[model samples]
Target: MFVARSIAADHKDLIHDVSYDFHGRRMATCSSDQSIKVWDKGDNGEWNCTASWKTHSGSVWRVTWAHPEFGQVLASCSFDRTAIVWEEIVGESNDKQRGQSHWIKRTTLVDSRTSVTDVKFAPKHMGLMLTTCSADGVVRIYEAPDVMNLSQWSLQHEISSKLSCSCISWNPSSSRAHAPMIAVGSDDSNVTYGGKVQIYEYNEVTRKYAKAETLMTVTDAVHDIAFAPNLGRSFHVLAIATKDVRIFKLVPLRKDSSSSAPTKFEVQVLAQFDSHNSQVWRVSWNITSTILASSGDDGCVRLWKANYMDNWKCTGILKGDGSPVYGSSGQPGALSGVLGSAAAQSALNGATGR
Candidate 1:
């Protein structure tokens, strides 16, 4: 079971996204107000606003933290058609800070002509790589050849999905047996495309990313998508938010040495839930990939987990103010943070990650 907690996020406009740092000790939020706020957990377990500043000219759509190994770095995308990297400096002041902690803009990514919808940093194992998707259906990947030089980034590759993209997630598997993979979801209203989610894999032969698989069954407009941490599993698990909350497991099929084809997957729908009875906006997985939390138009956050038989079902529901909603899915349970540094799982802004 799970419980909810409320935060007084003081944004002038609609809050769009919240992301927790690697250690779960810090949280960052972005909004249509075009500003980002950083909160630090105190010794008493309460979160305090550490820094808040305007980072973009237009509405900020999403914000994500790079792995702690890369330093205190953040990437945010905006409707202004740019994605920017921000780095925290200890001595600088933002004027609103209680201390001298502040964040400085490192670089601005200006490749997208349309609103940049989502931005994500690659897995810690992938070096300092970043990916951003735009409303024009284009995905751009950038790499910082030198992690110390955050201002200099090389646009490594650009891929066009041909469908207006909404979100993108990198597969965080450290296993060398598989090539780097990324899943992209589209929010295009037209269902004629047949499939709204596409998985791409890096091709060493061509030194580029190639389409590996398409989740043809998901025909609706997808608002969010996430790849669960592999955790030594032979297959990959993905959670998606559309009209429903769905989970799929993709097991790789052995490849023939002579064939020049990419790896194929045996796709299976592990679970699907329309509990919200309306459009689901965002989905997120716990650090262990065992539990998933989703938010929808009903203004509630629901948690899903698998039983011993591997049957995924609702484990809890969090209503407004972090209270456990009285329902079949929720019992009078104890309060718990999904992750030690869990951000909003969110209802106000939108859930993205743990």
Candidate 2:
């Protein structure tokens, strides 16, 4: 059996989100430390810190990288009532030979009333849309600047929900011919009473986006959701982490059934493994879409893999020496820093001695 490799360390507080770049060459993580650090692969097969930035005044809750279409642009959300954008710049030959980078601050967006909870970019290239959810129970879309300028993002429209949104994910399977679509999950009260996973479709003729339908509701709150990564073909699955981690095979149709009520989409439960004792915080898929990783308030990271029968089984667990991920306790940042540093060192040292 192949062993699980330690990729990076934990945060000082709970790690709210983890995301990979389009090429899967880099990873970005955000935590309660109020900072976002970008990790890249080194020649020795080790992960090294490429860049770091303190983007949020309060704890950063979520982060996502822009699609290849956007050229390394990053978006992060925080409890500080704002979301900030970050970009990476490759230094010129002379500057690179001297081992230095010319980093720049492209833009920063602020929301006065609501604390931004999550942020996501459209999946395709040359895409100019961005979606953000806030504590004000509103989801807003903005048109990214044509160039690198971020002085102002034109607000497209805002969709209001009964409760604040906790998470959001854009469908990666839709092609250019079809209208864009996004899925969102809200708090438990909203999940049980209001529509849980609401799908929004962009209408070009109306120049507006309308709620097409609701997916499925759960008994507990929905915290995080992720679209499956495409190996060679487009991703046709979505995994949701909340009170439970659920995998759904998305069946995209050429013509969307026009219905106003919540229709339970034919979702196949690939696997449902209860590895975490507490509420799961985040879930991610590798480029292959075969393996899944989940983190929880229980302070453990569990790895799940699909078997021959297409059944998902818990294969590994990463424990944190007994720490609480939710409350004011637990040192998620320092521990993660040390562990990440150690992991990098180990990879550099190779399969030999430490």
Candidate 3:
């Protein structure tokens, strides 16, 4: 069974993005009101606001958390045409109150010519790396030279795309035998570009990122894309949010021993869902990548799962009225809600009463 539990997270304006930490115990939210707030889940299964501060001079578009091994770090991109890295200082005396953790600005990446649309921390195995995309159609990757130092970062690579890049996700699997890979999505609605989704692979010999593949079927503007966390699967699964929710499977080809040509791969559409009648804005996979949760303009969040036969199906849907509608198969449902509303209410009430 599924039930909606709303906790108030008062924010002054529209909340643009929310990101949970690797452990899923902490969350960070950014808003158009130029502020960011942090929440921690308590032992009682409730969430409380721990910190809130004015973060940027303009609307903050996205906030993402680095792996916990990096010490509670966060990255946010904004309409101010810059991205900021924040670090949480533990056991520090707050200016207004004693014995509170203080979040300090670590470094500001100011390279984008237009509004920064997205920011993401690279997988932990990649070691202290961050990537950002902007309305200028450029993607920049930055790295902390020293893992212990959060204040200094160096621009490692910059790639310019033909369309406005909206979001990116790093392939979490790190096999020393294979090159690093990342998936990028653009917000371009033009069909002439072939597709809004593209994959880039890092070439060790050339020391550059090269285009691996383009998903030609996704013609609509892509709001977000995520490469699922791989377990032991031989192939990779990618979830995309266009006008609808689309899933694709990427199978890598074995390198030919006799030939010197670079390795190749194939991408096939696995499923396309029309459950959300409007545009889907976000798609997130659980840690196991066994299920996917998507939210859209319909004011609802839908959960999709695959059966043993590899057939994908909608398992549950959470409506705006806080009701769960199960699929015909009678599988158990999952919880979903409007995270922004809770933040807005909390912001207005000036207390954690909700």
Candidate 4:
């Protein structure tokens, strides 16, 4: 279930992406208007725009936030073939009140010859690392040699893909036992070459990234992909948005003592849903990874959950400004077809983390 909340009509073009901060108290939205806006949640549970500025010359594709420990840092990628890192600095005020925070450009990554589609910061334990995917069919990882300095970055590794890359997600867990993992999705509509979704793992022995698995079942162009937050589960869960919403369970292979082979992983489809009826553009998982929110071209956002028996079903749906339109899988006490306001509020509260 979802309630209607509107941002001011400041953007001149379509908004491309929205991302929440690590604590869910703030959100950043980017648009084709070449601008970005930051919103903060108030004590009354309403979101208010705090800052809005133009950050790029071309259309901004995506915006991502670093961990709060990094002191209010953000990264944005644009169609200008460059990615910029911005840091927030508190301004000096003559009055006895605190002044507004000013954002300054720290670094510009200009390695991509084409448009940069996505940018993601590595986990906090990785020490100021970032990964960017481009329309040039390349994925580059950059690291800051010193965490205190934000302007200097060293390109660590570059991997070439067969098709244009659209989005990427990094595994958030910092377990040293398992190699760092990332998932990349391709937006190429051509089906002849079979470029859809690929997973890469950091090979510590070779000091580079290697392709670990390719999802063959997803033949269509993938719009977004996300790896769920691991909660001591034996297998990892991944969600992909294409023409439909597909969930997969990834299992890591055990180390072989006899042959000394490298570690590998296998993926199996856990569930698929076509309720959107159109191209699904975005998919996001809650903090617990129990519920998933999906937005599509159908102008609706739907929430899905799995029962105790592992059967996935639609829990709630939200259309335009009206109340949440419950489906047949709604709770037992809910109305046969429609859910009451109290029930919808309770359901939506559980879906969103604070």
Q: Which candidate achieves the best TM-score against the true structure?
A: 1
Question: lDDT scores for all predictions?
Answer: 0.85, 0.63, 0.79, 0.78
Candidate 4 lDDT, tens digit per residue, 1-354?
Answer: 234555563778877877778877777878888998887879987877777789999999889999988889999999999999998777643432342346778999999999999999998888889999998889999998987899999999998877899989998767766678888999887876564898888876677788888888888988888888777777788999889999998898887433323457777888999988988877887767877777676666676778899988887676534455655665321122233221222222221100
Which sections of candidate 4 miss by over 4 Å?
Answer: 92-99, 256-262, 328-354
Candidates 2 and 3, the one with greater TM-score: 3
Model 2, span 1-354: residue lDDT tens: 222346554456655555667665677777777877777767776767666667788888777777766677888888888877766678633534343343456666675377788888877652667788887778888777674565457777788765668888776655564456677777645444745666676666666667765655454677777777654443257777776677776554444445433223445556665667677767766555666767666656655677898778765555543332332453322222222321222121111100
Measure candidate 4: CA RMSD: 5.3
Best-to-worst order by TM-score is: 1, 3, 4, 2
**Ranking under lDDT, best-scoring first?**
1, 3, 4, 2
Q: Considering only N, C-alpha and C atoms within 3 Å, which residue pairs clash in candidate 2?
A: 9-336, 10-336, 11-332, 11-333, 12-332, 12-333
lDDT of 1 by residue, 81-162 (tens): 9999999987555454366467899999999999999999999998999999999999999999999999999999999999
Give the per-residue lDDT of model 3 (tens digit) for 35-59: 9999887898788888889999999
Report the poorest 10 consecutive residues by lDDT, candidate 1: 339-348
